[model samples]
Target: MENVTGLVEGEETTAGEAEFYDRLRPLVASYCRTPRIERVAVIGNEPLGSSEERAAMVDSADLVFRVNGFRVDELGSERAVGRRAEVVVFNRGVRPTPWFFAGYPERLYLMIEPGRLLWENPKLPEFWPQDLGIVTMPNREVVLPLGKALGADPRAGGQWATTGTVMLWIATRLFPDAHIDAAGFSFVDAPGQTSWNHAYGDPSAVGVEHRIDLESVLVRRWIDSGRIAYHR
Candidate 1:
């Protein structure tokens, strides 16, 4: 893999190209252990309608993954969304909440900046912790192939995969043997819906950068193929 420097612009001391791959190697090994991960949960930010059993299942998974701006305690009840987040995947542009950084050191953070493939530099948010190491997915290695698989036309304008889809893709690739469960993902069902119903904040409109129609098709294919088990 080629090295891309300056993950956070103007902050030269933080881990750049070398550190990213260094961290990724061990992280992959840790999850892809012998006997394999029994169950892996990829929790979306959408509300779970306070289903206690569903939330419990998410918490019980061997690995629980969450996306940007996820809320656990703030949700007030474990029924809305589980309280376990071992891995957090976010887009480079996301401005995560304070609670999102609560247990910063312990969680595995992966930033997906597909723009980096175009030689674009990433600038971290002011709230980003300086000590945190950045483990970014290689655009050519992960993003491009994934985009192609989902029918993305790189030649087209502003067509990119959402962070949630990227997280699911990563989980499937890394833990091939584990049974993957996805919860709170309502986009596929309502591709025409403009706003997002999150577990934490008010509803926000979908961004122009993402093509929900394209993602919905891919996700539906995954569900039908039994690659991942979907939960409301």
Candidate 2:
């Protein structure tokens, strides 16, 4: 565990880095004690047909996990996409907007891609959430090797797993006893289309690189084995 200052990208360390890590360490320890739950929902931002039954099913889960740039507002939201998130995962490349923290007020954990965030956010540790229960890192050392082993493309210099894929993996590891459910994730685009990017931006809008086909293959395997209950 390197210090947060060294882990995040920036020429100079910000004042908040030390204090934030100081508070973060103890909180992370406590978060590990979270009681086992029967179900955990991992939400993606893919398009879905709105259904009250689906929404109620997601809402009924004991814990919910959402990835970057998801909507929790009432207006124009589907019932299947619940309003609450117990844990939120973020990509390092995307800076945490005000809405990111706002949507997870009761956050039990704030999972982040530290190395990527450091490279992407040149400002380093500025404008971060201080009140979250715990800050967890999905380190590249863990992500890259595991993703490669799971058929992720190695051509991108080992950075290929999307946030949804990472979230799925995390849910399995963290809540082994819980039934993992996922929604809003369809790895392929429409017929005769290129890769289907997430709901947050236009296709190829960001510099982040990933192999959607490989991720889709892996996800499909997980679905087949009943590891992930994907909302079709």
Candidate 3:
């Protein structure tokens, strides 16, 4: 498929897409309301290693974000990774479990498709739950700017940022005044690790689409600049 900044062939904006944005604007407005978000926590799928306080800290945040395939079971105990998920960010390729879809209408769902930078409309996954309102990030508005911030060149293939990183970027952009913290990320420590230690499943090899080496540098830069308070 050809990747471009404008609409791809055979793709057209639809009413459903308009409705999705309509639902999104209000949710964003609510977050940006008076008193603003004081603290924002972004939780990754990695297991929380030996930190008894991580879960409590995550739950205490005014806004909590979790990425694809997140779980709250024994594998992802409340004592380890927290219980609240006010914002859930997922990629189109994720094969999320039933628990990932729980607590509907109460949480904000945002789908990030870096591929949408090459195409216009989003193709909903077959497993996506019906009747749920999800806001799909616009490529030009979200992905492109983020890619540039990470020093990614569009000419360089296979450099797409992972959904977790994009979620963190989104949190920083939407709630600029909020104190942002993150945990359960392993990229900084194990950038070359070939497989994932996801909270919900057996280890799986990392996909080639993500350049973790680049992502690690950006994340470390964020930590160093105090843009994010990273916990192990």
Which candidate has the highest TM-score of all? 1
Model 3: per-residue lDDT, tens digit, 18-119?
454455645864643234577888988887664568877887787788899997544543377777788889988788866688876677788888775554
Which parts of model 1 have CA positions greater than 4 angstroms off? 1-25, 28-36, 73-78, 117-121
Stretches of model 2 off by over 4 angstroms after superposition: 1-35, 73-78, 95-99, 103-105, 114-127, 130-134, 138-141, 153-156, 188-208
Put down candidate 1 lDDT per residue, 44-131, tens digits, no spaces. 8877677787878887788888898887744654466777787889987776766588887778888888766554577887778899
List clashing residue pairs in candidate 1. Answer: none
Candidate 2 TM-score over all chains jointly: 0.69
All candidates: TM-score = 0.82, 0.69, 0.81
User: Measured by TM-score, how close is model 1 to the native structure?
Assistant: 0.82
For each candidate, the alpha-carbon lDDT, in order, equals: 0.72, 0.58, 0.72
